[model samples]
Target: MTARVGVVTFPGSLDDRDAARAVRIAGAEPVALWHDDADLKGVDAVVLPGGFSYGDYLRCGAIARFAPIMTELVPAAASGNLPVLGICNGFQILCESHLLPGALTRNRSLHFINRDQVLRIEAAGTAWTNRYTPGQEILVVLKSGEGNYVADPATLDELEATGRIVARYAGAAPNGSQRDIAGVANEHGNVVGLMPHPEHAVEALTGPSTDGLGFFTSLLAHLAEGSPLAGAPTG
Candidate 1:
């Protein structure tokens, strides 16, 4: 059966369509989910695409965190029955929603940075990253105003010790993210949030590289195994 991946569209979401198209290209059915809809329509997974939701008011994802759809998403994700990937502003929402730890602050330079960035995979255990080998390097697009990730040192230590730092900038940090982190996955690995826009790079013709397609394909493989959507690391 083809996996059904739901791409959410919040008020000012700019990449929902791109996310859906990437899902299709990955051989999954794209399901357009609305912010107001509580039901996920039995999707196998979900993607929170990047955008300036609520005009980035109060904070990038502050307002979108309370959207009705998140009511179900929160618990569903916690249950480990569904996989969730948040990109860019979507990453902001995930952090705000407490689905992941830490916060995305303004760039250290206080400017919106846009470019093709290289990322090193720190953990290949997550459902969305199994296609990569740990420590693998891949290129993806990174574009956002508030991209710096911050958390207490203790939390940062815990995340690193537990292999939760899923990805990190390959060379010089672009936005002052703690530890040069580019993305992270929750303990269960069902929820992942990344500062870069992977969906944007899934198409080679228009994007810098097709490396992002691995994320979508990895999820499908995980679901097909009838396992918990997350693939927590094992020492």
Candidate 2:
């Protein structure tokens, strides 16, 4: 059976369609989920696509964190029963919801940064990152205003020690994220949040490299294994 991946659309989400298209191109059925709905519609996994949901009012993802869908997502993700990938604004929401550690602050440069960038996979043992080998570098697009990731020093130390830093910038830090981090995942490896936009990088003809397609493909392969959906690294 084809894996079904859900792409959620909140009121001001700009890249939901792109996310769904990427899922389709990656050989999965794309399910359209609404922010107001709590049901996941039985998807194997979920992607919180990039965008300024609710106009980025109080903060990038502050308002969207309380969206009805997140109520279900929070518990499911915490239980390690679901795999959740949050990109850009979605990453902001994951932080706001405390599903992932660290907060995304305004770029230190104080401006929106958009570019195709390289990232090193620091932890391949995550639901969303299994397609990448540890230490491998891949290109993805990073675009956002508030993309600076921050956490307490102790927390940062723990994350690094636990190998939770899923990816890091390969060159100059684009948003001044701590330690040049581009992404991190939960202990169970089912939840991940990243500053870069992988969904946008899936199509080679449209933009930069197609390195992002691995994320979606990795999830499908994970489900096929018939193992618990988190914590294993992909080859």
Candidate 3:
């Protein structure tokens, strides 16, 4: 069966369509989901694509966190009954939703930074990352004004110690994210969030590279297993 991946379209979402297309490119059925819709249309997975949701009002992703869809998403995702991937502003939403840890603050540069960013896969066991080996590098588009990620020392330590760090900037960190962190997964590795936009890079002709294809494919592989998720990973 073709895994159905839902791409949410919030009030100001910019990449929901792109995410849906990437899912299709990865051989999964892309389902368009509305932010206000409580139902997820039975999608096997969900992607909160990037954009300035709620006009980035009251702070990025702050208002969108309480959307009706998230009421259901938060619990299902937290319980590991569903897998979720949040990109860019969506990452901010996940953080705001408490689905993921830490926070995405204003870029240290205080300017909107847009460019092709290089990131190294640090945890390949996540449902969204299994297509790559640890330490594998890939390029994805990153465009945001508030992209710096910050967390308490203890949380950062736990994330690193628990092997939940999914990806990190390959070189000098852009946006000044702590420890060069670019992405991370939850305890179950079923939920993930990142500052870069993978769906934007799933195609070579239009995007920087096809490196982002792995994220969507990885989830498909995980679902096809027909078993509960279980994997051992090292930090």
Candidate 4:
């Protein structure tokens, strides 16, 4: 039974297909989920690929957070019974959904920054990051205008103390995220989100090195541990 990973496609999503392809390349079955449909289709995990969901209205993921599908996803994720990986716009959704801490704000540069970004894995205990060893560095494409991650100083301290800071920009803070954070996970380690796109970097023949493959592969190892996510099926 191959692991089934669901990729949700919002109206403005641009990389849903790429995300599904990356899941397939990582040896899992990719399941297509719709933004309005609340059915998860028995997937072992879910991925919210990057894009300008709802035309980035009001804020990036603010409006998309209220999508009908998120109605189920929210509770499922909050119960810590589901594994979710939110990339770029999806990251914004996670934050807006309150599944993750902090908010992705406008970059200090105030321009859409597109570049191959290097990131350091700060923690690897999350379901989506188990394949990466702490301190490991990998490059992936980062493109967004409102990509800076911010939170109150106290909240930031709590995250650090709890080891919730999963990854950070390796060198220059490309988007000026606080402390150069590129990704983070919930306390239970089931929910994870990142601004850089690992799916885009998964195929060497297509773009960069295959360093991003680990993100999807990591999910396989994550759910193989017999998590309690309902309807989950895995190889």
- In candidate 3, list every pair of residues with a backbone clash: none
lDDT per residue as tens, model 3, 1-235:
7788999999999999899999999999999899999999888999999999999999899999989999888999999879999999999999999989999999999999999999999999888888899999999998999999999999999999989899999997889999999998888888899899999898889999999999999999889875555443343
Alpha-carbon shift of residue 218 in model 1 (angstroms): 0.6
Best-first order by lDDT: 3, 1, 4, 2
lDDT of each prediction vs. the true structure? 0.90, 0.88, 0.91, 0.89
Tens-digit per-residue lDDT, 1-235, candidate 2: 9988889999999999988998999899999999999999988899999999999999989999999999888998889889899999999999999899899999999999988899999888787777789999999898999999999999999888888898899976878998998988887888889889888888879869899988888787777875674444332
Candidate 1 residue pairs that clash = none
Candidate 4 — worst ten consecutive residues by lDDT sum? 226-235
| Cα RMSD (angstroms) for every candidate in the order listed | 1.2, 1.6, 1.2, 3.8
In the range 19-132, model 4's lDDT, one tens digit per residue, is 999999999999999999989988888999999999999999999999999988999888888899999999999999999999999999999998888889887777887788
TM-score, predicted candidate 2 vs. hidden true structure: 0.96
Model 4 collision count: 1
Report how far residue 84 has shifted in candidate 2, in Å.
0.4
Q: Which candidate tops lDDT?
A: 3
Off by over 4 Å in 4: 227-235
lDDT of 1 by residue, 176-212 (tens): 9989999988878888998998888898898999999
Q: What TM-score quantifies how close candidate 1 is to the native fold?
A: 0.97
